[model samples]
Target: MPKARAITIHRHFIEPGTDWNTEDFNFSDVLSAQGSSGDALSITPNFRAGAAPENAVGGGNLVDIFNAAAEWWERAILDDFDLTLNFGWAPLGGGTLAVHSLVAQEGTPNRETEGTIRFDNDGSSLWFLDPTPDQNEEYQTFTETTTTQLGGGDINIGRVYTDPVGDAIGRFDLLSLAKHEIGHALGLSRANRSFRAENMDFDIDVQAPRPFPGTEIPTRNGAHLTLNTSLMFPFFVTGERKLQSGIDILANAEISEFNNINLNPVHVPEPTSTPLILSLAMGVGTFVKRKSLKRQSGL
Candidate 1:
């Protein structure tokens, strides 16, 4: 039998309105590749200094929204893995949620700690650059922002568009934005050929489906993932009132599978030379016995 594997999550929510998104944004279901669920990678609900609280529209608190998002992650991933999410209210100096940690902000002055800010998606299309240009070399970036606004008579959480004219807009619920940022934290800056190298965040200037010379490649678990329904998909919320459906399902499955593999790894046998050692030991013992008998007989 293989040993059981376990995991624990420790997360601190980025102060509300922190500018974590850059050239592009990444969104994912809450579960890890294994079916574990936790708030280890979630953000706080209340707007911090300078953040516009007038934009949040959902009728719930941070705990409720986070729990709902965590459930979604749990459903997406499979069972058999340990997952936990810890809630925290500590502040952070702006950093990357999906690519790497926070870094210095240039070009655009860092916005107020918690208020409306602009996203830079102009260079995001470059993420798809291919070594060899071809007919299939195309790229696009999906970017948006979340802020508070007055809607239907009260303050609400709403998404502000960052795409250029005629570019598609992605509408996300507040919880959805947190989920997206979590994907970035997991090192998904842009979609790539395989899940093992999936960089779904917006930090890079590369795009997906580039002209790489190879057939479809499988993930570390030997499974091939299609663009649609992949946890690494760039877009999160769409239209109004619709959280990305079936996210928890994927997160749960991935987390579970990862844990199973870790808990039960394949074992390779030792070398085939062990029996030779035992045979040599028996030959030495027999020669000793014969010598002792000859000495007894005075031969």
Candidate 2:
């Protein structure tokens, strides 16, 4: 087993007053290959039946949704690396929809090699797995009365949609959640050194007399992006399905560049072109262990 530094927990939350819009955004259209000859990125998912069943929700395949999420990144990042992600279900406290724990490299606190993702199975909120896209746009808006570690509040998880333009009001989209978690695994987080360095550069480039328009201020304890539509945003709305915006791809590209890996940049948008979307309501937090731990087998 490989020794790893302390686990860094990235939690996802459900916020109120956020609703899905009627925009048809395909990740493939925005993240198409830029003719890079680098090898494709490979992600191996290990579904574990620990604490709770891996696919507790009925009527949909959790593994399939996870793979779909992985594919989204694979298309954008062409680096040649094999990453293993352990998936499981557990009671991740309240207000949290899911969590991503990165296994840092031994003796190197800033470098991450693998990760684990656990979904909320504590019966706090209803879960739906919409395997296909639904065009009906009859969804309700919600509000958060109280906030918890994960994002505790009132929500209506009635339906699920694979894409962002469907009608899945009151329901959390599993596909979208998976994509957000995987972004953390791929180094789109401020917890990683590369991400932090890139963010600092972004700020400097836009400050004072610079020509850049905005700054890269991280929210949620420096773990998530603030005031942006990046998939790595901490707050998740009930029915909204967000794809990887240009900021997300650029963030990951910085990580790849740090690792000396080349990525396809054909469709990656300029950082200035990144749009600012509605800011959702929720409390964002990250749990960082001060001590190191032995890496688990097969993780």
Candidate 3:
């Protein structure tokens, strides 16, 4: 690794979709608190017979769940960068990972497809679209949302980005998606690979060879797409999520060049508690289904 100047990468978490409390207070106290529905409160894991459960059972917020996701990944990838990365559900200068409301972008009626962030031509800036700011607007950052989880479906499919591992039920897991997209935003792209950057080696792992039925793995060169996979494997499998061993190294290398930093910098979120250091069964989504991310779309 070559040495360069250190740079600070600003990380913004945008929530165009549902959000937790704009600011944190008490979660448990909100149940039976009040409402237009006037329904009684019960935070059981099962779905109740009304809009209340779908909208406000337990009053759990995806925003806090996402915050925790950022926290886990940030802690996991802090080895090589002199990072001052900040993660928040606000509009800061740094690149953003946004989630928008369905009505905002006139995007697609399909709930299954959420594109990644849109970047500028210079590759110097990017922001998310959705949670429309106005009828004719592109986006409204962090719109007040009330979308909550209904847990206990195909928990492993990675639909909801908030479900935790070993939990009785599941929702979409956001760790892998957040980490992967952030990786792209920071400097993981086909362009960098084509540019002959060392990190793009895509090396194959021959040392830690695995038995059949094992998750794909990558070495320093490239991966045997069929044999093993990593976090950046180009496709996310249902219930799948885990950072590859070598992906972080490439991140460090790329950021070193992009920021002219002594190291490549990336940010996850700082954990408010002990995190589960386990791999998720990565998911397959519109973005992951594509053979590769667009030349520079970053989506």
For every model shown, the clashing-pair count is 64, 8, 33
Model 3, range 28-60, lDDT digits (tens) per residue? Answer: 100000111111111111111111113121223
Per-prediction TM-score: 0.31, 0.55, 0.31
User: How much lDDT does each candidate structure score?
Assistant: 0.25, 0.45, 0.25
* Tens-digit lDDT track of model 2 for 1-299: 54221222222222222221213111110110011022255555766633323433424556667766666666566544556676656565556777766554222324446666666667663455655422112222211121122122221111122222223545566667787777777765444565566565343112322111242333443456553344666766665555565445445544534232222222322223323223334334321111112222331
RMSD per candidate (Å) reads 27.0, 17.4, 20.7
Candidate 3: stretches off by over 4 Å: 1-8, 13-62, 76-172, 191-196, 199-229, 243-299
Q: Per-residue lDDT of 1-299 in model 1, one digit per residue for the tens?
A: 54332222223334544554433322222211111023122222322222223333323344444445444333332223232233322222232111222121111111111111121112221111112211111111121112111111111111122221111123233344444433333222222122333323211212222211121222221122222233334343332122222222222223222221111111222322322122111222211000000111111
As a TM-score, model 3 comes out at: 0.31
lDDT of 2: 0.45
Give the candidate number with the greatest lDDT.
2
